[model samples]
Target: MDARQTWSSQLTYILAVAGATVGFGATWRFPYLVGQNGGGAYVLTFCIAMIVIGIPMILVENAIGRRLHINSVDAFGGMANGKKINKAWKIVGWMGLCGAFGIMAYYMVIGGWVLNYIYNIIFGNLNLTSVVSADLTASFYDKSIINAPFAISIATLVFVIINFVILVRGAVAGIEKAAKYLMPILFLLMIGMVIRNLTLDGALEGIKFYLTPDFSKISAKLFIDVLGQVFFALSLGFGVMITLSSFVRKDENLVKTSVITGVLNTLIAVVAGFMIFPSLFTFGVAPDSGPSLVFKSLPIVFSHMFAGEFLAVAFFSLLMIAALTTSLPIYEVLITVLEEKFKIKRLKAIFITLGGIFILGNIPSLMATNLLSDVTVFGKNIFDAYDAISATIFFVLTSLLCAIFVGWVLGDEAKKEILFGSNGAHKIINIWFFYIKYIIPFLILVVFVSSFYDNFIK
Candidate 1:
C-alpha cells in the first residue's frame, strides 16, 4: 500500500494496530493460556513480558514498516546490503501471509461459533444436552460446520465491503472513523463484563489465578510463547502494520503509537483474563487449561454459573466482536497486497481471500478434531503441527531477519523514525536493537534448537 493511501491520523493507525493486536491473543486465549500455564502467576509474567520484549518489537515493526513503505519481506531484503536477500526476505512475507490467512481460515470457523451462540441466545434457545459434558459440546455441536461457514461467508462479504469502502474513502473517512467508533464500543462492552465478573463468587480466586505469579512455570518454552504472542498480536512481519503505517503522513508519531497500541492491547488481555478466569470458579470448573478450557469447559461451566440464558448471551457477544476485530485485519493484509500487486479491485481481492479461506477453513470444520492434527509428517495433528511451524519455525526465521534488518542494515533510518516519534524512546530503541540483535534471537534459537521436532516432514 502506498503511504498516500493508508490511514490519515496517527490515532487511527494506532487503533487499527490496536484492532489487530487486541483480540484472541487477549480475550479467551489469554485466560486459557493462564489457565494452562499454572494460573495467575503465568498471566502476570506474560503481561510483564509484553512490556519488556513486546513493546520494543512493536516499535521495530512500526518503524520498519513505516520507513520502508514495503512489507517485511521486501523491506527486510532492501534494508540489507550484502548478499541478495531479495528471495530470502520474500519468504518472510509469504510466511506471514500464510500465517495470517491460515489463522483466519480456522478463526472464521471459531468466529462462527460466537455468531451461532448469539443467535441461539437472542432467540431464547439453548443447545443443552444431558449427556454432553459442558467442556465438550455434544455431537450436535458442529454449529460452525453447519451455521458458521454461511455466517462467516456473510460476515466476510460484509468485512470486504467495510474495508474497501474505508480504504477507498481515504484515511479520515474510512480507517479513523471506523476505529474511533469500533474500538470504544469493544472496550466498553469488555469493561462492563470485567466489572460484572469482579462481583462473582469465585472471581477473586480467578483473579489470583490470572494476576498472581507462580515462578516455577517460567521456563524457556513459556517465554518463547510469550515472545510469539507479542509478535502474533502486533501483526508484525505480515506487512499489515506496514500497510497501515503507509497511510500516515511523515510527521505522524510511530513510536508513541506503538507503545500506546501495545499498552492498550496488553491492558485488554489483562482485563479479559480478569473477566474470564473468575467465571471458571463461578461455574465450578478448573481454570488451568488453555483453548480447550474455554470451548470445551467454559460453555458447560457457564451453564452452571449464570441464570437461564444470560451467560451465553453476554460471553458470546463479546466474543463475536473480539473475533471480528482480529479477523478483519487478516483480510485487510491480503486485500492490501492483492490490490497493490495485482492491481485487482479491492472487492475482487477480498472475495478471493474470503473464498480461498472459506474452502481451506473447512479442513478443520470437517474434521472431528483440530485440523492441526491429521497433518502428520510423522504423527501430530495438523493443528499442533501448524502451530509449531507458524509460531516457532517461521517466527524464529522472521525475527532473525527483522533483527538483522533493523539492527544491522536499517539502523540509521530506524533511529531517525523512532526518535522523531517520541520522548526518551531512543534508549528503548537502543535496548530493542540489543535484544533483537542478540537476546531475542538467542532465545528463539534455544527454542528451535531445544525443540524436539516430530518426524513429520509433511
Candidate 2:
C-alpha cells in the first residue's frame, strides 16, 4: 500500500467532514421528518439524540480511524500498537462500505432531481405563473421530473460523471477543495432562504408550528426515528468519519474535532427547519408532505413569492452543492476500500466504483417512472427500499458494532487517541467512555430491533 495523504490543514479536515455530514439529510429529509413526526416533539428528540448518541459516536469513529491509520476494514482488523485483532471485526467495516455504497446509489438519483430542477427553473420549462396552485406544483414534479425516466436517467448520468471527474483528482485537491468552497456557499444560501421565508406573510404561524413543543406527539417510534436521523445526519457508521479521520494529523485533538463537526452538522439541520417549515405554512401547504416536501411544496411557495424564479434557482443550486459535497465523501469510502484492499490504481478504482453506482442507481431512477414502477423490495419502491435498508439496517447495525468494538475491544487505545492532544480533558473521558460502552450500544440495539419490527413484523 502507498503512504496515505493527510489533510492540508485542520480547518480543511473539519470542513470536509462537516460538508459530508450536513447534506440532504438535513436540507431535504429533516424538515419533512419533523413535519411528519410532529414538529417540536421530533426536534426535541433529535436534539437529545444528538447530545447523547451523535457526538459520542463521532468521537468513537474518529478515534478508531486516527488510532489505526488504515482503511476502514483494516482499521478494525488490527490495533494501534502493531497488534492484530480478530478478523471477525472486519464485518463492521464491510457493513459500513455497503451502507455507503447503498446510500450513494440513491443519493445520486436525488442529486439528479436537484439538477433537473435547476435546469427547468432557469430555462422556464416549469411554466411558472402568478396563479399557480398546489396541484399544479405537484403535477410539475410528478409529470415532468419524477415520472420521466429518460430525463431522470440522463440527469443521473450527468451527476455520476461529475463525481467521477472529482474523485480522480485525489482527496486534498478534490474532496477537500469542494467542501472548503461549497460548504460556505451552502450555509449562505440557506441563511438567505431562511430570511426570505421568515419575511413572508403568515410566516409566524409556521414558525410556531415548527418551534412549539407538543409532548403528546412523542412515542416509542419517534425515539427510534430520531436516533436514525442523527446517525444519517452526522454520517455515523458509514465509514465516512473513520475514513476521513484516517488522514488527520497525529497531534490533532479528536474530541474537539468531533465536537465541532457535530455542532455544525446539528445546527445546519435546525437551520434547514427554519428555511423550509415557515414557507410551507405561509402558503398553507401541509407541513407533513413526506418526501415530496421540497420538490413539490417549495416550488409552489416560490411560484407565489416575489423573485420566485430567482429563489427557485438559488434553492435548488444550494441543494445540488450540498448533495455534491456529501456524495464525494460517500464515494470516497468505496474508492478507498477498493484501492487499499485490491491494490488497484486510483483511476481504475474510480471507474469501477462509478460504473457500479451508475448501474445500481438506475434502478431507483427508472423506478420513479412507469418503466419499473411495479418493482418493490420489502414493500417499498426501489428508491425507498434502498433508503430503508441503508438507514435502518446497515447504518444502525454498523454503528452498534462499532460502539462495542471501540468500547470493549479497543478500550484503552481508543481512549488515548481521543485524549491525545488535549491537556486536562481527562475528567470527562470517563463519562464519554460510559456512554459509548453501555449507553450507545444499548440504544442502537433497541433502534435496530425496533426498525426491523416496524419495517417487517409490525
Best by lDDT: 2
- Clashing pairs for model 2 are none
Q: On a 0 to 100 scale, what is the lDDT of residue 113 in model 2?
A: 86
* Top candidate when judged by TM-score against the true structure: 2
- lDDT, residue 251, candidate 1: 68
Question: Model 1, 1-458: lDDT tens per residue?
Answer: 34346565666778777877776767766677677778756666677877766776676667766765653345555533434444565666666677666566556656655565666646645543222365345332445433344554554445434444655544335556656677888888888777777888778887766667789878765665566666666665555665566555666777778779878888888788777778777766777655655555656655565452566566676776676666666666676677766678766776687677666653444342533334563354544555556555665566556666667666666777677656566677677667777776565566455443422232
Model 2 segments more than 4 A misplaced: 80-83
Tens-digit lDDT track of model 2 for 1-458: 13779898889999999989988999998998999999988988898889888999999899888876778887897654457788989989999998998788789988888888988888988755564788888888888677888888888889889888888899557998898899899989999999998898888998888888899999988887898899999998889999999888778878788889888888899999999888888888899989888998888888888889899899998989888889898888888888888889999999888888888765564564577778888888888777889998999999999999988888878888877776568978878998889888888998999988897677
User: Candidate 1's C-alpha lDDT?
Assistant: 0.63
TM-score for candidate 1, residues paired by index: 0.84
